[model samples]
Target: MRIATYNVNGVNGRLPVLLRWLAETRPDIVCLQELKAPSEKFPAQAIADAGYEAIWHGQKSWNGVAILSRVGTPVETRRGLPDDPDPSQSRYLEAAVAGVLVGGLYLPNGNPRPGPKFDYKLAWFDAFIAHAAELLASGAPVILAGDYNVMPTELDVYKPERWTDDALFAPEVRARYASLRAQGWTDALRHLHPGETIYTFFDYFRNAYARNAGLRIDHLLLSPALAGRLTGAGVDREARGWDKTSDHAPTWIELSEQAPRTRSASGSRPSRAAKPA
Candidate 1:
């Protein structure tokens, strides 16, 4: 199965580009971020016309997320982080598709550090990590995919020194990311390429895409149960050059078919005896 993540920036404005990519590179499952629309404005018909069924959590003008399934309707597991009882901004959506629990997140882009926004970013990370741990404990095959908004390492950015003070590259943010990984979530791209500098996002300014000066802030983290099925992972860098596209290019992974295991009636969780491909 092939799963991909793309931050559409503005889903309505980018519908055509989104449809084009959907046709050109048909991923079985897709996690979308930055919808920038209210729940009612999700363009359900257009997406349906493109042959994908979607479940989305949307907020007006910023930070929305969705999960799309090409094969069937994704059974929604949740809409927002449980830790936040009354979340006004949409930022997460989880669903089950093809037996995998997919968590789509649009992490905060805490630009100027040393402020409330930055503090919220860190707090959100903490709450997210706690929920992630809960998901891990459920023993379900899970994939957390989206624009994390945190550059985890020097290799993930074009110039480490320039980003030192930025919240995305702040030492504390990186440490939190490392802490999450220590819990056994595999960063798919890093696991596959190791030493390569792979970027999934490029700034619209300074001819960043042309210069190939980009950041790998978007990521797909796999739980231990699903990591071993990972066969390949990469970024569709060329997509960044598409007309009126989001800063983020599509990032994806391939997984070989695994032996079938007992599943719940909803096929949300695989049995413990399940083996990797």
Candidate 2:
């Protein structure tokens, strides 16, 4: 199976680019973030016309998340982070596609840190950690894919020194990300291309894509059980140059059909959360 994630920026504004990418890539499952469209304006029929069944959590002109599957209707497991007591923002959605539990997220881009926005960003990460803990406890083969707005390490970002104060590169933010991964989810792409130079997002204003100066913020993190199935992983950098394209490109991974069943690092049996299609 081929699973991919892309931050479309806005579904309606980038519909053409999105459709074209879908036609060309044909991933079995696609997780989208930042739809920036209300649920009523999701253009479900248009997506259905492209041969994918989808479930979305949308908000007007802001954060949103959705999952589209070619093999089956995605079963929505959750909409927002469970422990977020006041999560008025729509930034997450979980679903099941072809037996794989997938989560799509649009983490806050808390720029100009050391302020309220930055605080919220950290709080959001905390909530995500709680949710991730629950998923890990469930023991299902889960994949958390999206634009996490985090640069895992210096190698994950271009000119790391220049982003010292950036929320994405902050030590606290990186530590929180590490804590999430420490829960037993393998960073699929990094696992395949360990310490390799891979960039997934670029600054449109600075011609960053053309210069190959980008950050590996978009990711596919698989549970330890599902990691063995990963066959190939890549960033579709070309997609970032399409007309009205998003700053983040589509990142994807392919898995073999006959891979070994995934199990916890400790050899514990797996379990799953209930989902609704």
Which regions of candidate 1 are displaced past 4 Å?
A: 259-277
What 10-residue stretch in candidate 2 is worst by lDDT?
A: 268-277
**Would you list the C-alpha lDDT of every candidate in the order shown?**
0.86, 0.85
Clash number for every model?
A: 0, 1
For 1-277, candidate 1 gives per-residue lDDT tens digits of 8899999999999998899999998889999999999999999999998899999998999889999999778999888898863388788899989889999999888767999889888888888899999999998999999999998889888888898889999988999999999888999877867777778888999999888788899899999889777777878777788999999998888776773343222332212111111
Candidate 2 residue pairs in clash (backbone atoms < 3 Å) = 225-262
lDDT at position 40, candidate 2: 91
Query: RMSD of model 1, in Å?
Result: 7.0
TM, every model = 0.92, 0.92
Candidate 2 ranges with C-alpha deviation above 4 Å: 260-277
